[model samples]
Target chain A: DVKVTQSSRYLVKRTGEKVFLECVQDMDHENMFWYRQDPGLGLRLIYFSYDVKMKEKGDIPEGYSVSREKKERFSLILESASTNQTSMYLCASSSSGAGWGEQYFGPGTRLTVT
Target chain B: ELKVEQNPLFLSMQEGKNYTIYCNYSTTSDRLYWYRQDPGKSLESLFVLLSNGAVKQEGRLMASLDTKARLSTLHITAAVHDLSATYFCAGLMEYGNKLVFGAGTILRVKS
Candidate 1:
């Protein structure tokens, strides 16, 4: 099984506080992605990492950043968390092989910015 | 810009009934994907349609893609409560690096 794990299942942070969400994948996939899910908007990509230390912005990457210092780990950073940033965060990893970018997702972290 | 649209963002079905969710894309795409996300849970990859007229099925859910029409459909047969979830369809754009997802269809299967 491709196991993707997140650091926290639920988190609460004060507005303007810095928040970090960690994700780790066991399958040695070369690609990692962070997404935020809202009620009617569905899942929007925040950031994605193709290789270690390589990052790319997705659709909604203004308030968020990401890090990939290691192959198995990826982290999402919120510089100044706001109430609007409170959403379910999902981490996904995919192999660069014939899988053709099939993403396997973690259980997701529900972040509440108060 | 690449845009993906899904019709009937919400669906309610009774057990043993059947329905189909539609996904359409603006730009040309050779690949389409389907995912299922349960309440408060992350998404699970359901099917990957890599070509025109491609169809894949698992359990009671089946997905088909038509590259010519830039459309994909997820058909549910004999719906059950376990099939209730938010279904998302994404299309791989030209560069193939990013995926544009639809608004998603929330399926509620009733007893």
Candidate 2:
């Protein structure tokens, strides 16, 4: 089974603070994604990395950024955390092989910005 | 812009009942995915529909796709309490570069 792990399951931060969420995947997938889930809005992609050191902005990438310095590790950074940025953050990884194989997700990190 | 929409944003069903959730998209896409998310948890992949008329089933859940109509359906048969979750269907746009997700259908199965 593919294993995706996050650094923290829950986190609380003050406004204007910097926050970092780390994700690591056991499988050598080529694609990694960061998403935030909110009630009713479903999951919206924030950033995605297709290769090491490469990144692309998704739909809601304004207040967020991402880093993929290593193949197995990806990190999401909040420049200035705010209450509105508090949401369940998810990390997913998938192989670039045939059929766009299923993206395995981590348990998610629930960040609460106060 | 690519848009994905799911109907009946909320569903309440009884055990031994059957229901279907609808997902519609506004662009040409060959890949569609079904995912289930429990409260306070990340998404779990349910099915991947890669082509028109493709269907997949697991346990009591079934998903099908129709590229021509830009639609997908997730059907639950003989629902159980454990089947309750928020179901979302996402369409791959930009040739699979990104996934556009629907608002999601929150299914609640009562005993």
Candidate 3:
């Protein structure tokens, strides 16, 4: 079984503060993704890393960035937290092997930016 | 731009009832996935449909994909209260393996 772990399950930050959400996967998957889920909006990708030090912007990357210094860990950074940034964040990892490669997700972190 | 759409955003069904949720994509995709998410929780992968006419079943839930039509369906048979959750269908775009997820269907099963 694959396991993805998030650094925090719940977090609260004041406006204008910086926040970090961490995700680590035991499967050593090559692809890691960060997504924010909102009601009626589904899961929108914020950033993704295909390899160490390589990152790509997804649909909703504004005000957010990502880091992939190692194969097993991916980090999401909120430059300046705001009330609107409060939401559930999810991290997923997938392999580069055969087929499209099913994604394994972490438990998720619900961030509250006040 | 690849787009995924799910029909009937909300559904309330009685226990032991059956229903189907539809997912449609705007373009070609390499694969499709069905995932279940509980409130304030992460996603649990339910099924992965890889080809046209592909079908996969687990428990009382079955997923089918029609690549030619860019459509997927998740059918629930004799659903139970414990099965209540938000179901999302995601399509892997051909180019970069980026997943595009539908808005999701919220299922409420009652006794």
Candidate 4:
């Protein structure tokens, strides 16, 4: 069974606070991505990591950053949380091999900024 | 940049009815994916179409891809209440391992 776990299912943060959302996968996947799901915009990629300590900015990475220190762990950081950043955060892991594989998503973290 | 769009963002139908959700992409895409997301839950991959004129079916849901048209369709047969959920279609980006997703279609199956 494929499993992707996140640190929190629901989180509340104050403005100007630094927030961290952690994700871990047991599938030995080489690619991990973070996406924010909004009502009308669908899921927008924030950041992704392909290898340890390697990161790339996605379509909407303005207020987000990510860290991949270990093979199975990926972390998303909000330098300063804002109300506009309130959205459902999802973590996904996939294989980067020859053929593209379907990404396995985590349960997601619903963050509310106040 | 690639863009994916879906139509009839909200659909309501009675049980046993049939419907289709369409996905169109702006640029060329070789791989397409369909996902189902229930309320307050994560996404579940339903189908992956990798080639032109490819068709795959699982239970009551069937998906097809047309590379020449840059389009994909998810057809639902005999809708059930348990099939009520949001469906999303995504196109694989040209250069990377990223996907451009459509805005999703919310289907409500009523008894």
| Model 3 agreement with the true structure over B1-111: per-residue lDDT tens digits | 789999889999999999999999998888999999998789999999988999999999999999889999999999999999999999887887688899999999999
Number of the candidate with higher DockQ, 2 or 3: 3
- Candidate 2: C-alpha lDDT: 0.91
Give fnat, all candidates.
0.65, 0.59, 0.74, 0.68
Best by DockQ: 3
Compared with the true structure, model 1 gives a TM-score of 0.96
- Which lDDT tens digits does candidate 2 get at residues B1-111? 779999889999999999999999998886899999888788899999998999999999999999999999999999999999999888887565577889999999999
Over all chains combined, what TM-score does candidate 2 have? 0.95
For model 3, how does the per-residue alpha-carbon lDDT over A13-64 read when each residue is reduced to its tens digit?
9999989999999987999999999887889999998999999999999999
- For model 4, the superposed segments whose C-alpha errors exceed 4 Å read A98-101
How many steric clashes does model 2 contain?
A: 0
At residue A40, candidate 1 shows an lDDT of: 77
DockQ of each: 0.72, 0.66, 0.79, 0.77
Provide the TM-score, chain A, model 3: 0.97
Question: lDDT of candidate 4?
Answer: 0.93
> Which order, best to worst by DockQ?
3, 4, 1, 2
> What ranges in model 3 sit over 4 Å off?
none
Looking at model 2 chain A, which ten-residue stretch has the lowest summed lDDT?
A: A95-104
| Candidate number that wins on lDDT, 2 or 4 | 4
Backbone clashes for every candidate come to: 0, 0, 0, 0
